[model samples]
Target: MSRENSLVSAQWVEEHLDDQNVVLIEVDEDTSSYDKGHIRGAIKLDWTTDLQDQVRRDFLNKEQFEALLSSHGVGNDHTVVLYGGNNNWFAAYAYWYFKLYGHQDVKLLDGGRKKWELDSRELTDEVPDRAATTYVAQEQDRSIRAFRDEVVAAIGSHNLVDVRSPDEYAGRLLAPAHLPQEQSQRAGHVPTSVNVPWSKNANDDGTFKSDEELQKLYAEVGFDESKDTIALCRIGERSSLTWFVLQELLGKKNVKNYDGSWTEYGSLVGVPIALGDEPGQADGKSA
Candidate 1:
C-alpha cells in the first residue's frame, strides 16, 4: 500500500498487521488509554513525553527524534501507522511532526480508536517486545511548520486560520477546562486569523467529511487553494488535524501548521493580538 495518502481504513490496517515493514503506534493525549487496551503489536507513544522537548516548549531535535524512532524499533523504510483517542487529535499531530522531520512513510488510522473499537477489531493489553533499530533522521523541513516569528511575519501576507473554539478565539476563555496545558497568559487569536473549529472537518463517526462537504465548509470561510495558509490552535495539535485536512486531503499546495500556535503567540510580549473580530472579518462577530 502506498503511504502517499495520509489516511487508511481500519480494515486496511488490520490486513497489514503482519507486514514485516509496518509499524503501528498509538499516540494519545491521555497516555493511560494504552494500559486498558490497544491494537496488538502497537507501541504506545505519549504525546506529552515522547514527542515534545523536555527542556523547551518545542518539538524534539533530530538526535532526540532518532532516539525515539530507534527505541520504538521504527526504521526508515517502515510504514508508520498512528491512531489514538480524542478523534485522532494527537494522532494527526504525530503525523505532522513525522512529516516535519522528513519521515517519508506516515499515515493516520482513519476514525482512530473509536472506529477500531466500533468495528470490534482486535485489541490487546500485551506490549510487544522488539529489538531497537538504528533509524536515520532527515533534515528538518520548515515549510510545513510555522514558528512564532514566521507567523508574525505572515500575519498580513498569508491566510491565517485559528482552528479553536469561538470562545477561545474571542478572548472569552484561555483554554478548555479539560486542556489545562493550553492555558496561556492571555486569550484571543492572532490578528487577522479566521475562526474555523477543527471539528467541522470530521463526521459524527470520527471519520472525515466528504470532499464536497469539506470544500463547502472551508469555502464558507474564504479558504481556497490559491493562497498559502497557516492553521493554529491553543497548543498546535488540533491545528495539525486542520493542516492535514487542507494540505493533504483537500490537496492544497502550501498549507502550514503553526505548532507554537496561540500558546506561544498569546503569551509572547510585544506582539499584536486581536480579540473577537478583525476588520472585514470572515464572519462578523461581537464579543
Candidate 2:
C-alpha cells in the first residue's frame, strides 16, 4: 500500500496515476474545467452537486455520501487524492468533508490545479471507466463541525477566525462576485472573530507554505495549542483551507469548521455580529 499524508505533490500523483489503490478526484466549482482537460484518469467531483445537500444548507447525509463515493468507485481502502481550480478552495473543502465522514486516507494535491498547470503536466479529455464499489462512510462527526448556536455560545470563550478577504471581513462587500446568494443580510464577520484571510496560508503558486512560515502566520494571530479554534468564510468553503492548514499542517487538534459560516450566522435573527475592520469585540461595536 502506498503511504499517504495530508498532502501530496503533483509529481507524486503523476507517478501514482496507475496505482489501483489511488483514486484521483478533481473537485472544482466549475465542472467545465474538467470537460476541457484534467489530470489523466481523474474523475470529476462537482462540489456543488456531488457533495452538497441540494435542499438543505448542509452536506449530504451518510447514505447520500456513500452513494456518491460508491458511484465514483471510491472504496474506503482507496487513497483519495483531490485537487481543483480556484486555489483548491472546494478541493480542500471536500477534503474536510471526507474526513468528517471518516474517510481516513484522504489527501490533497499540493498547490492544486495551479501548480499542475505551471509545471506543464499532461492533461487528458479521455475519462476512464471505474466500477462501482460498496463504500461505508462513518456517521457525520459533529466534533469537527460547529452549529450556529454552538458558535454563539462560544462567542467570547473560543478562538474564531474569519478567513475571508479584508473587504468582506470589514463589511465592505456582501459576498464574492461569483456567489451572490451566499451573501448575508448583514455584511460582517461573527462577533469577536479575527480576520485572517485564508490565502495567507498558501504560496503565490498555490502550494502551501513551509511549516516554519505556517507556524509564524498563525502565531501572529495568537493561535495556540491551548485554544479551541473555529474558522469561517462566506459559506464555509474557503475556511476549510484554513481548517486543513491549522489541523493537518500545524497539528492543532481542537480546530473545527463552522460550515454554516457567515451566510447562516450573519442572516439569522438575534445573532450578534461584528462589523468593520476591527480585530476583536463581542458585538458589532468597534473594540
Candidate 3:
C-alpha cells in the first residue's frame, strides 16, 4: 500500500471532518486519554478492552470484531482514520487490526494526537452520536501475523527486528522504562534480532520520518529489505509502527508483526533466547 493511501495528515482529517464516509478513531495505551479530550467527531477504542478477547490472551474473533465495529458505527465501506498518543503506538496496532480483518480503506493520522496538540489544533470532550451499521468483517488474514513457531524458525534467516528499548533488548528490563517491569519469565531478545527502538521512527513532534530516512534507519540495522521480516516488542503494539513503516511506507511486501512478541517467546519453555545487545550469536547465547 502506498503512503498516500495508508497515511493521512491532520489537515486532511480536518478537511474531511464533515464527510459522512470518514470515521475518526482514537486508540491509546492509556485508555483514559480519549475521555479527557480527543479530536472532534473521533470515537475511542480502548486497546485493553475493546480490541482484545476478554478471557483469552488473543484478539477478538471475527464475529466479535464485527460486533465491536458495528456497535461503534463503523460501516464496511467507511474510511477509518486512527490516531492516538505516543506517536500513534496503539493507533498503529488498531490500524493493523483493520487490515487483518480486510478493511478496504484505513489510514493513520500522521503524528497522531501529539502533532495535533503541538499545532494547537482543536480538541473536545464532546463525543459524536453516530448511527450504528451492520459492519461485516472478513475472516482473519494470517499473512501479516507471525506466531511464536514462525519466530523460532526465522532465527538467523528472516529479518527479525526487535523494536524495543536498549534496556529491554539487553535483558536489563522486562518492559519499557515507564511501564511496570513484568510479563516474561526471561529477558533479552530473540536470537539474531537487531534492536531498533520504535521511537526512532518518529520525529520530536510525533510525525514519522521521511521515507528516505526510514529506509536508511533499517539499512543501518542490517535489515534485508527483500527478505521476509517479523517485527516484535514486549507485546506487539510498538512493532506495529515499524511494520507500517516497512510495509506501508516503504512498500515492502513480506513484513509481519509478531503480536505474541516477548511476552510469549520469552516465557516459552526451552526456546533459545539471546542476551545482551548487538543481536548476540546465532546460537542464541549472550553476546
Candidate 4:
C-alpha cells in the first residue's frame, strides 16, 4: 500500500502487474463470474467460500485468514490488491476484511475489473497457482469496529456510522441474510448513528469518485476525515466498503469496521436497540 490513505490508480496497478509480492484477487459472489473471465494474473476467491467463515458468516478468524493469505503469497510486507467481477462491492469488502485482520499493506484496485476491462486491459482464463506459506497475524485493530454492547453505550456519542441503505435504515427493507424473526428485534438503526450508506461513495460502475467529492460527501453526513468512526452494515461487507472509503480514500486514520455486523447483533435479543435516536440512546431502530 502507499504511505498515505488514497487509492492506487488503474495505471499504477497495471505498472506493477508482474511484481512478485503483489497479489491480485478477482472476487465473485458466484463462481460463474470468475469462470467467464478475469484480469490476467488475478486469482479468484469465491466470497461465499474462500473469503468468509461459512458457519460464522463473519470474516474468517486471524489464523484461517492469515493462512489463506499466506497460501496466496500475501505477507505483512506484500501488497495485496483486490478487485471484483461484480462491480467493486465484494472487492472493497475483501480489502476491509484483510485490514481488520491487521494487514496494513493492502489496497483496492480503483475502478475494479469493470473499469480496467472497459479500458481494454489484459485478462487471462488460466487456472491460478499458489505457493503454500505460513503468515503471521498482525495485532488486530479493535477500535475501528464495535459489537452490540459497545454500540448501545454510544447513545450520546456521535462516532458510529451505519453504512446500510436508507430503506434498511428506515426498517423498510431488512437484509434477507438474517432470518425474519431476528429482524423484528431492531427495526431501525443504533441510536445517533449516521446513515452514510456505502453505495453513496461510489458511482454506478462501482468506482469511487474524486477525493474532493469524497470530502464533501462524508462531511455532509457529519463524518469528517479525521474523526474516529466505526462502520457497520447488515453483514460486514457494506461497512468494510465504508472503512475503505473513510480510511483509504479520504485519509481518515481513525476509521474502523464492525465485523460482527447485524448477523451477530440481530441475534442478541434485548441487548439494547434504538429506533430513531443514534447508536447509544437505544431509543429507536434502523427505521
Candidate 5:
C-alpha cells in the first residue's frame, strides 16, 4: 500500500464525515478517551476488549471479526478511517488487523486525535446510529505477520527492528516509561536486532514524518530496506506504527509486525537475547 491510499488528513476526514461510503472509527491506548469526546459520528473500538481474544493471547478470529464489524454497521465495501490517542499507536494496531483480515480499503487519520485537538477542531460526545450490515472478513493473511520462530530466524539474515526506547533496548526498562514495567520474564531485546524507537517516525504534532525523513531515519540505523523486516516492541502496539511506516508509507513489501513481540520471545525457553544498546552478536552476548 502507498501513502496516498493508506493515510488521510484530518481535513479530509472532516469533509468526509457525512459520506455514506466512509466509516470513522477510534481505537485508543486509553479506552476511556473515546467516551469523553471524539470526531462527530465516530464509533469506538476498545482495543483491549473488542479486538483481543478474551480466551487467548491472539486476536479475534475471522468469524468473530466479521460479527464485530457487522454489528458496528461496517459493510465490506466501506472505506474505514481509523484514528486515536497516543500518536495513533493503537489505531495503527487496528489498521494492521484490518489488513490481516484482507480489508480492501482502510486508512489512518494522519496525526490522529492529538493533531485534531491541537488544531482546535470540534469534538462531540454524541454518537451516530446506523443500521447494521453483513460484513464478511477474509481469512488471516500471514504475509504481514511474523511469528516467534521467524523473529529468531531473522537474527542476522533479515532486519529485526527493536522499536522500543533506548533504555528498554539496553535492558534497563521492561516497557515504555509511561507504562508499568512488566510483562516479559526476561528484559533484553532479541539478538542482532537494531534499536530504532518507533516514536522517531512521528513529529511532535503526532503526524507521521515525511517519506524522505522516514527513509533517512531508518537508513541511518543500518536498515536494509531490500531485506525482510520484522518490527517488534514489548507487546507489538508501538511496532505496528513502524510496520505501517515501512510497509504502507515507504512501500516496502517484505515488512511484517511481530505481534507476540518481546512478551512472548523473552519468556521462551533458551532463545538468544541481547543486552545493552548495540545490536549484539547472534550468540546473545552484549556487543
Candidate 6:
C-alpha cells in the first residue's frame, strides 16, 4: 500500500531494516538523543553540528557546508531519509539544507519519529558505527535560498512569503516563541512579503493538513501554489517545512526556503514589514 506521495511507514521501515540504500538520519536538537534510543539502524546527526555550518554569527560558508554532508555518509547516491527524534524542528532544517545543496531525492520521514514511537516501534540504544562516506556536494543552489540582501532586492520582483505568525511579520512580535530583545533590531519584514504562517499547514497531531485544506488555506492568503513562493521564518527551519509541503507535496514549480529567515532579515536596517491590516502586506499589496 503506497502512501499518497510520502515515504514508508515505520512498519515498512521495520521490514526494510536491512535495505542498504535506505539511510536514516535522525536529526534532533542534540545528536545524543540518537544514542539514547532511535530506530534500530538510524544514524544520529545533531542539528548544530552536522546540519548547520555556522560562521562567526549565523551564516553558512559554502565550501565548509558541503564538506559536512560528505562526512556524514550522505553522498549523492544515498537515499537519505531524515526524521527528528525531537519535534519536527531540526529535521525539517536538515531536509531543507540537503535539498539546497543539490540532493533532490532527500525525503523527510512523514509525521516524524514521534509518530513512529507512538506506535511502539522497535528502537535501539546502541549507536551504529558505520564509516563515514564521502559526498561531493554540488554547488549550492542560490535560487532555492534567500538571504537578507536577496530578499531586499526581490521586494517587488517576486513573491516573498513571511512564514512567521501575524505578530512576528508585523514586527509587533519578536520571535515565534515571542522572546523580547533589548536593542530591538530590524523590526518589519521584506518589502513585499505576505503573511502565511508556516504552522497553519499542520494539524494538532503535527501531521500535515489534507491537500484540499492546504490548497484553500494557501489561496486564502493570496498564494496561487502554482507560482514561485519564497518562505521565511525566524531561522528558516519552519519555512523549510512549508517548502517540503509545497515542492514535494503540492508539486509547486519553484518554491524556495529562506534559510537565513528573520534572524537575518529582522537585523537588517531596511527590509519593510507590516502590522494588522497594512497597505502592503506579504499578500502582495494588502487585502
TM per candidate comes to 0.92, 0.95, 0.98, 0.83, 0.98, 0.84
**Model 1 TM-score?**
0.92
Please provide, for model 2 over 1-287, each residue's C-alpha lDDT reduced to its tens digit, 9 standing for 90 to 100. 12137999998999999999999999887878999999998999888888888998778999999999999899999999999988899899999999999999999998999899999999999998899999999998887888888888878778888999989998888887566645428888888788889999889999998889888988897765677989999788899999999888778878899988887887899878777887657765777
* 1-287: candidate 6 lDDT, tens digit per residue: 01253444556677767877778888876567777788877888766755554555543556666676656665678777778844466787787777667775676676677877787777888666665666676677776776667666666666677777787777777675534454355655666677777778776546677788877877776775445678888878778877777766776767778877777766765346554534274433455
- The segments of candidate 2 whose C-alpha lies over 4 angstroms from its true place after superposition are 1-4, 177-184
Candidate 5 lDDT over residue span 1-287, tens digit each: 78999999999999999999999999999999999999998999999899999999999999999999999999999999999999999999999999999999999999999999999999999988978999999999999999999998999899999999999988999888887886648999998999999989999999999999999998998888679999999888999999999999999878999999988998999999888888999989866
Q: Candidate 2's error at 143, in angstroms?
A: 1.4
Question: Scored by CA lDDT, what does every candidate get?
Answer: 0.84, 0.87, 0.93, 0.71, 0.93, 0.69
The clash numbers for all candidates, in the given order, read 0, 0, 0, 28, 0, 4
Tens-place lDDT per residue, model 3, 155-265, is: 989999999989999999998888887663799889999999998899999999999999899899888866899999988999999999999999987899999999999
Q: Which window of 10 residues has the lowest lDDT sum in candidate 4?
A: 276-285
Candidate 5: the clashing residue pairs are none
Q: Candidates sorted by lDDT, descending order?
A: 5, 3, 2, 1, 4, 6
Overall local distance difference test of candidate 6:
0.69
Better of 2 and 4 by lDDT: 2
State in Å the error of residue 125, model 4: 1.8
Point out where model 6 deviates above 4 Å. 1-6, 30-32, 57-66, 85-87, 178-184, 225-227, 277-287
- Model 1 stretches with alpha carbons more than 4 Å out: 1-4, 180-184, 277-287
**Which residue pairs come into collision in candidate 2?**
none
Query: After aligning candidate 5 to the native by TM-score, how far in Å is the CA of 239 from where it should be?
Result: 0.8
Worst 10 residues of 1 by lDDT: 278-287
Candidate 3 global CA lDDT score: 0.93
Candidate 1 positional error at 118, Å = 2.7
